[model samples]
Every structure is written in C-alpha cells, then in structure tokens.
Target: MSDLAISVRGLTKVFGGRRVVDGFDMDVPKGAIYGFLGPNGSGKTTTIRMMCGLLTPEAGDGTCLGFDILRQSQEIKGRVGYMTQRFSLYEDLTIRENLDFIGRMYRMKDRGARVDRALVDLGLAERAGQLAGSLSGGWKQRLSLAACMLHEPELLMLDEPTAGVDPKARRDFWDEIRRLSARGVTVLVSTHYMDEAVQCDFIAYIAYGRKLISGTPKDIPRLVGLQTWVVEAGEVGTLEAALKADPDVAQVARFGAMLHVSGTDEARLEAVRQRHPGQWQKLDGGLEEAFIWLMSGAQDNFAGPAARGGA
Candidate 1:
C-alpha cells in the first residue's frame, strides 16, 4: 500500500450559496497523526468530512485509505473510524455494551471476544459494566475511542475529541492516539488547541475553507516568514494601542504577561520596535504566531456584504 493514507485536491463544499470549503488540498501520510486546525468557521470540519467520504464535495478528487473518495465512498467509509465532536456512544448502555453494539453493527464473527479486547485495550475492562453516561469526560473519550477501534479501521478521524476534556486526560488521550499511529493506524484529528496541534506529525492550517499552510510544526513558522519579538512590560495594552497605529506592526497579541509583536518583514517589525522601545526580547516565532499571521490574511468568504445573514 502507498504511504499516503489521504491525498486530495480541490475539495469544495458549498452551503447556502457560499463555499464553506473552497478548493482545498491535503495529504496525510499513513500511520501519522495529522492535525487540522483553523478558526471555528474556517471549514476545518467540512474539509475533513469530505476527505473521510462522509460529505461529498462539489468538486474534488481524492483517495482515503486507498479507496477513491468519489467512486468508492462506501469502501472508504468501511475502513475509516470516525469519532465526532460529541460523545456518540449510548449513555444508557454499559462500556462493554457499547463496544458489543458497535461490533454487532459491523457483524464481527467473534463479537464477544472483540468487545473484551477493546475493553482491555482501552483500559475499561474493570468498568466494563459501568454505564457510559456515568463516566467522566476522559473516560467517555476512552469509550468513544474504544468503540471506533472495534472495527480495526486503517484510518481514524477524530473531530475535536478534546474540547471539554481536562488537561491530564487530554494528554493521556493523545498518548493513546500516538500509540495507535505507531501501530500503523493513520490518524487525522482536528483541534483548536495550539498545544495539541503541535503534537501532530504534520499539520495543515486552513482559513475560510482554504489551506494557508501545511508542514511539520517546526517548518510552518519559518515557512510563514514571521519576525517575532516579545515585549515584557507592566502595561501591555498601552504599548499595544501605541503600536496598532503603526503601519509596520503587522500583529500584536498578548501572550500571558508579555506582548507578542510580529510582522512579515523583519526590518518593518524592528522599526516598530524602535518606535516603542522597552524591556523587550527578540526571539524565534512558533506555530501560534504563524497561525495568527495566516488568520490575518484570510478573508471571510461568507461575511461579505451581499448574500449573507446578519447576527
């Protein structure tokens, strides 16, 4: 089999006469955790659905798990394990029951053994009889993951699986995902958290349904060509306001107690710094800085003056 689990181009999805996902392209290598990140309305979810064969794109050609997205959607679906944003397992059913139910849906030959193994793999064997609803968010996440793995899918698609999960739980869940990836399961997960996005083997940042950049987390910042400096001052808002009026200052954001001042051109950014001198430190930028730069350049395709609804 090819090393690329997903390879697609020009994936488009239109809703209400607006292209929510416009001419998107992505490539996820097999057994790698690929992070899909963007603002809420930037079409991250829409693009993943198209890639997973759940939502048909208006125009695109792609292969997911080696099945043609356009012509073999059913084949694609069968091999892909999808876990949605919400907790999708039955609340009333026990953990083992949920796994059994999923196994039955797939009509596995040894349903009982499959359920037992899933429980053991997910560390839910002790609580096999406990109701899914009663479990904590992290446990619920574990249950959802266990259910998805019941079919032994080649690809796993997770949509914001750590939204409400606690920090420790989120870390543990990601560790599990990495374990799966190491076992030759390709994982494509979407997340808003920058920390989580940085953990992926590869990342793709999309804005307004268009891809802004795709690369290793380390490569993205350098590729964006952002020059960043941190201003450590008692009054950041005052300095931020003062720099906002300057044309050379491309972006100014508060990072904890400090201010992250950045721009595309180093000379221009330095000029902005010289204009407002203080206890500042010039440092290498990271993914968060590059993402903000990407967002600033993206246009809201649906927020145009005509043909749109008002809030």
Candidate 2:
C-alpha cells in the first residue's frame, strides 16, 4: 500500500462561473492528522469534498485509499468516514439507535457488537437510550464522532467538529482524535481554531481558491518570514495605533494586554523596536501570526459586486 492515503493534483470546482476551488493539490499520509484551514468562502470544504469523492472535481485526478477518485467514488466512500460541520445524525433516534442504523447502512457483519462498542468507547453507554435531539452540543458532537467511527473506516474526515462546543469538550474530542491517530487511522480535519490547528501533524492554508502555505506548525511562520515582537505596555491601544501607522510594521494584533507587532523585514522591525518604549521581546511568530499574514494577501473571490455564496 502507498504511504499516502490521499493524493490529488489540479483539483478544481466551480459554482455560478466562479472557481470555488481552483487547481488544488494535496497529499495526506497514512495515520496523519491533517488540518485544512481557510477563511470563509475560501473553498476548504469544497476541496475536502472533492478529495473524499463526495463531490466530483471539474478538472483533477486523484486516488483516495488507493481507489480512483473519479472512477471509484463508492469504493472511496466505503473506506472513509465523514463528519460535517453540523451535527447530521438523526436527532429523533436514541444514541444507540443511530449507531445501529449507520451500522445497518454499512451492512456490517458485527453490527450489534459494533454499536455496543461505539457507545461504550465514546462514553455514551449510560446515555445509550437518550434521544440525540436532547443532548447538548458537546454530547451531540460525541455522538456524531461515534457514528462516524461505527463502520471502522480507514480514514476520518471531520469538518469543524469542535466548533461551538465548550473548551473541555473540544479538548476531549481532540484527545479521541489523537487516540484514533495513534491507532493508525488517518484523519483529515478542518477547523478555524488555532489551538486545534497546532495539534495537527500537517497543515494547509487555503484562500481565494488557492493555497497560501502548507507545512508543519513550527515551519509555517518561518516560511511566511515574519519577525514578531511582543509589546508589553500600560496602554496597548495607543501603541497599537502607533505601530499600525509605521510603514515597517506589517501586522499588529492585540493579544490580551500585549500587542504582537510583526513585519517581513527583520532589520526594519528591529529599528521599530529600538524606537519603542516599554517591554519588547523579540521572538518567532506562531501559527496565528502566519495565518493572518497569509490571509492579508488573499483576494476574496466573493468581494465586489460579483459576489456569490459559492463556498
């Protein structure tokens, strides 16, 4: 078997004459937790759908789980488990009922055993009889994950699975994701949360239907070539204004009481630091800074009078 679980090139998708996803390329290795990130309408979801064979690409060729994405969608779908941004399980059904139904759809030989195991594994055994509709957002998320894993698919594709959930619940969900990854199940997840993005083994940032950057978390900031200085002062708003006016500072973001000032030119940034008063600590920029820097250069496809809700 190939080391890569998914490989695609020149993937494109159009809606209303706008290229929602344009000439995309991606490679997801087996057992990797890949983070797919982009701004709203940047085609993150569209690209994922095409990769999983749920949506056909206008122009592209790829293999998912060694199955031809265009010619063997059914084969690809069978080996992949998909969880959408929204909770999609039958709300009227009990937790156990939902799992059983999914197992039936997959025609699993150990349907009953799998449902029981899923409920137990996801900490839903006690609430097995509870209606899915009555569960909280976190519980519903847990149920969705449980349902997705019911078929024991080789790959798990989750779209913002932690969105709107409590912090603790989000942490718990990621713990489960890591456990699955440790068990050699490849995971492809989309999330806007930087905390979650940091946990990914690989990351790809897309914008305006094009890829801005992709690499390990540590390498992303370096690749963007941003030099950042953390500014600690009694009045950050005033300093923020000052930095924004300076031509050298490319980006200034307020983080709590401090400000993170960054720019592409290291010498210019250092010069700005010497001019500023208060505490200034120079350090490497992180994922958040790189994300903002990459996003600033992208042109939104929906901007102007020709806007469409394509994404």
Candidate 3:
C-alpha cells in the first residue's frame, strides 16, 4: 500500500436512490500516470472525488497520498490538485491573474514566484496577459492545469481534461503530464479518448458504476479475450450485412475505409471470416475494439444505445 498513490476498496456512492458508484476498488502506483476511463455517468468522476476527499464514499475506506480518505480528507485535499471536466477558472481573468488568484487561495508566501514558475512550466509565460475567455480550448485547458499546479500538489485528478481541445493541444497537454510523472508526481486523469487512454502507465474501465477492466494497456486486450480480423472492399455493402448475420462475429464496426470485425470465439469468427470475400487481414485485438465490445455487453442505466455517449 505504501507504493500506491491511491488505494481504495468497496468505494460506493449514491444519489436520489440510485447507486452512482458501486463496490469499486483501485490501486494506482506512485509517480505513474493512471488513466480512469468509462462512458458518461459510469462513476469515473464520482470515484475521483471520493479518492480526492471531495465527496465521501458511502461504503469504502482508502488512503490517497498517504492520508485517510475519510479521516484525513482535509489533508488529502490540501495536497492534491483537481481539474473539473468544464473550465472552472474565471474566464474573464487573464492567465497571470488566474494563477495569482489560485496561488493566493493556497495562501503561499511566495505566491508571485510560484505563479511565475507555473506560467513558465505550462508555456503560458508570454500569453500571461491574455484573458482566459478569449483563449482557445487548448489554451483554457493549459490555464486550468496551471491553476491546479499552483500549490504543487502531489496528485493531479483531471476529469476529462481534453474533452473539447484540439488534437495537438491534447497531445501537448499529455506531454506535460508525462513530464510531471517523470518528476515523481502521481496523476489520475479520466478521459474518454482511446488515444489518451493508451498513454497511461495503468488504466481502469468502469461501466454502470462497476469497474469492468483494470491493468496496463498491453494487458487489457488479453483480459477481454478478443480475436479480430480486418476486411476491406470497394463497397462492403453486402459483406457487412453477411458478417452481422453470423453469431460468431460479436462486434463489427467500420474503421475508416475498412471494417474491424471481432469476437471472443476465435474459431467461429475465423470460420466466418474465411467464408467472406474481401481484402481479409487477420489482426490482433485493440483497446478501442475491446472497449466497444465491452460497452455493448454492459447495461446503460440512464439511456438507450443511441442516447448515451462515451468511450
């Protein structure tokens, strides 16, 4: 447990007679970038809040950054940085003003120096005078991260930090996170992007408030027990319908110009694939395919197949 940045078990939360998070357990190693992933309302944010001491779990005990989540919540909160899904900082405030404000909120003696360092660290030194409202989504994300880092917390709990940002900005944001992890800062970030989820040292997928899968990215594919094949045709109009008719083809989706067909039953899937005609290529299972298959099997509490959106 000493090597863990977050250790929690039986973490549960409820609201309005609905269980939002149920019997969730997790262990995130220190200095590791841990990805918390799930569809919307899968309890990723609620679990983060519980681990960070912002919201108490109705049925759980844990320690975050060496502090008890229930008893030492204040201490845990003081040492951790949390960024919400939305831009919560003052939009009208300039980058410098925002950092200064956060620094003052932490009541640090060298507030100016810390803010300056944060600006330099986040590449906002030059744009420190620009208003956050006028900045792009990526820039606003950087500001929010800078705000979270003002006090130099040991853990960063970012909930979908790259939601509306561009690809380049998202990449840059993740690059900085890697730098922080290299400096021995433990980061727990929740994101729906498979590209971003792949960047973490460890990742966990939750569905309907239950943890579906958790492990290193390399191992998660194996956990799902999937076999895959790629099929490409000038127009796979009939081929797709044919594959769907077979029960062995558990999952099928168009991947760009081609279609990625997957199933847990490799023998049956391969047999079906052999019978089909197209540019057939046997492929290894992937994270995106695994997640899609997993989500399809899980029940969505709030809405139907088309109504819900996530990972």
TM-score of each: 0.91, 0.96, 0.93
Model 3 CA deviation exceeding 4 Å by range: 300-311
Compare candidates 1 and 2 on TM-score and give the better one.
Answer: 2
How does model 1 fare in lDDT?
0.85
- The digit string of per-residue lDDT tens for model 1 on 45-158 reads 788788877888999888898889988988887788999888999999988888888998887899999898888877778989999999999889988988888899999999
lDDT of 2 by residue, 130-202 (tens): 9999999999998899898888899999988998999999999999999999999999999999999999999
RMSD to true structure for each model, in Å: 2.3, 1.9, 2.9
Q: How does model 2 score by TM-score?
A: 0.96
- By lDDT, is 1 or 2 better? 2
Report the number of the highest-lDDT candidate: 2
Worst 10 residues of 2 by lDDT: 301-310
Clashes of each: 0, 0, 0
Give the poorly placed runs of model 1, Cα more than 4 Å off: 300-311
Alpha carbon lDDT at 7, candidate 3: 93
For residue 244, give model 2's deviation from the true position in Å: 1.0
Residue-level lDDT tens digits of model 3 in 101-149: 8888788899999988988877778988988899888888988988898
